[model samples]
Target chain A: MPQPEYDVVIIGAGPAGSTTARFTAAAGLRTLLVDKRQELGAPIQCSGAISRHALEDVGIVPDDEFIHEAIYGFAIYDQTGERHVHDYRSLKPDEYGSGPGRKPLGYVVDRRRFDRYLLTQAERAGADTWLKTEGRGYTPTDDGGCTVHLRRYNQDIDVRARLLVGADGLQSQVGKWAGLQTHIKITELAGCLQFIVDRVETEGLLEIVTGHEWAPGGYAWVFPKGHGYAEIGLGVIATMTDKPARWHLDKFMTQSFFRERFADCRILEVQGGGVPLAAPLRTQYADNLILVGDAARHVNPITGGGLHTAVAGGKIAAGFITGHLEDGMPLRDGALRAYQDVWLDALGDKMWKLYGIKTDIFHNMNIRERDEQLYATMADYFSPTSEFKKI
Target chain B: MSKQQPVLFNIGWNACINCGACVAICPQEAGFVSPFDTIAVDRPCDIACLLCEQICPVDTITHVPAPAPATQNGAGVR
Candidate 1:
């Protein structure tokens, strides 16, 4: 009988995995984090916008290193070019902070730097990390642990661990291999595209353009990234259109009002990806295996925002795994099932309701006819004053 | 080097961003992120679901007449 090399082996070194490692390793567990990328956060897939409180929730402070710009609030534009601003200054003036010393409602971050910072924090907390290492698959052992197969340095390697944490993002193989039903339908997925452009004017607000005319099954956004640059992107449901997300974005930038605004702007970079709009996975854990972050579909159903949820999910995963190992709980088929229930109590309820609202608003509807009304409905649901309780 | 299996389609690497949407939604687990960080479909196993083609936001994965057999260690960059 051979002992496992590490107490826990976390696949993926994104925010979720790193946060999990930070807590588990700090608790004296032999935690190992693996990522396929040679660089920790290259080829960014996210918009990199997150609430300020979200970073703070995980004990992370907004620093100049990764903070791209401070967001004061959101400005939503309807199809008619009508605008509605949700200013945090009005709701929480004190927290908004004023002048150079002011705090922001949210922030746009440099994801590459932010992700690297998180992994560095995890390593500093005593976790071992392997870069350019991909988790090929895993096989659960009879002893209630698993052997993770990996491809590293062009060679295959196997590692045994008492617990396997699947923090892998969108294309997570670990969760699917673990039989968590991670499949997403075309209608339930948002195909997204973005361009980081320069020479675009931007205020401190996150600008959102809604209506099918702008984006058939999704919406477009202009998120400030500081220093006269911003990310302009949109997402479309593949089932709703024959054209790709890029086509819609192209039309939006050239045929719409943005044509004038982006006339001289330079396209610095292009980013694209798929976002799962489905409900969170019902079971986030199976035996000694736990799925956190996007792997567990912890994203906000309507907004498609997951950074905050990912960080929080990581913390929850770490807490439960640490507790299970410390309690000497039998690592059987259901030893860690409590993690999902706990996560549900903490965050899953709101997500489920939001998923319902998302279905009501976008699923199987005539978007063009109801565009403005739909935009108003969304605004009400998202307004700071409105309780999410209303349908 | 072991001979790789035959693939049903060729990935358009020039435009692919390695987002892994194909890998996430593939029913047969045939689509995977190659060691080079690009998306690759496992040979002799894709079942021609074409989900990868439909799900790719960039529309970079395309079906081909016959993909040349690959080697196990090759990056398959094409």
Candidate 2:
């Protein structure tokens, strides 16, 4: 009964939750960010490879401490061991605004530090944060808000807030309890495995290997993590195969292309999880509730990328919450629903395009046929432009 | 695609987040909620179908593949 009432309560302290808390509290509204885990970034559920613009786009400085490596382009390997190295080097600084000059394709981050760093930002902005707190559920209050039931280290408490934001990843209980169906189709859930290993022969380039033999309906990745350390992982369509991801990783490790190169490597860590890559949910906001990040299924369908979406989404959610709390505007139905409209205006087309590409191209093609067609197409696409007729 | 049906499937308690996705998506009424209403449980793999395995969001429901049939084909797929 002693828990303080707040204007906003965000469940889950990952990137999305922290970003929303950061902006909401900084705008002078009372905010609270809660996570079930003892540590902000424990278990390290991500590949640590995030788009370089993820931080800056949300107004955070991309500090050097968290950056592990800069990727130039991709080296794509197909089913038959055919390699197509494409040089889609990033654009100049002018293209992305006042950022670094001549950017790389992306960056590999120390995600543990990155998540904690964002938490610090939220704390500095005056948001209250609670770790090791799990949300049991919630019930509607008469004042148009809800009382969230929480268990803090075996002790139960109730906290009241006008707005509830669920950033609780793919298995969001907050969203489900708030009357939003958070489950996606099995065809849309991407089960993934990641391993941090040494002795990787990557030359500052990202490697993507695709084939049914390696990963069914998806590709395996080798991300450069600097200092000869690499994060290798794969996502397989759950509907495509019944085999465990570890079984696939063992087979991938023994491939002739990777056997000798990874011979003496030691695996530092292993993490497994699922990513929801369906289109952003039909409604991430209703009444006084909202969802963001993986909970809202905002991940890019093709690459399963989500860091950028989480940051952008957090910022957009805060914008709506702040306006409603401070400007004396309504917070239900039409006004609050605009949160989704504003964000889709900012990022909808890109997500839909990636979804189309994922469903239309990669997901439908069997491994062998995709390899042949992809190899032939990229071979020409990345080849030096040739002059057919001088006239 | 003609492998023998699995006789048993074990659900990993550690991997389950109790999302109720398996219960909602299973074609058969194999999945159910326990007494607490938080954690979920499944009946068994007697259906010979892998729908529960496919529908598990966390990949926690592991399939136990049946031993290879003695008369299965031996032709190389590649």
Q: What is the lDDT of residue B76 in candidate 2?
A: 36
Q: What's the TM-score of every candidate structure?
A: 0.90, 0.80
True contacts kept of each: 0.58, 0.06
- DockQ each: 0.43, 0.09
For candidate 1, give the DockQ: 0.43
Q: Lowest summed lDDT over 10 consecutive residues: which window, candidate 2 chain A?
A: A382-391
True contacts kept of 2: 0.06
Per-residue lDDT over B1-78 for candidate 1, one digit per residue giving the tens place of the 0 to 100 score: 325343566787888877767776666553355554445544443355566777777888877544654668875536
Tens digit per residue, CA lDDT, model 2, A233-319: 887767777775666777788774777777788898776666655777877876778888878877877567778888888998899
Q: List the residue pairs that clash in candidate 1.
A: none
For candidate 1, write residues A1-391 as lDDT tens digits. Answer: 4533889999999989999999999999999999988786667778998888788888888899998998988888887678888777876787784466668888898989999999988999999999978888888788777788888889888888888899988778788776777777777878888999998999888888888887877788889988889999988877778877888889888887778987888999898778887799888877668899999998887778888889888988898889888887876667677888888878888899888877877754776656866678657655777675211
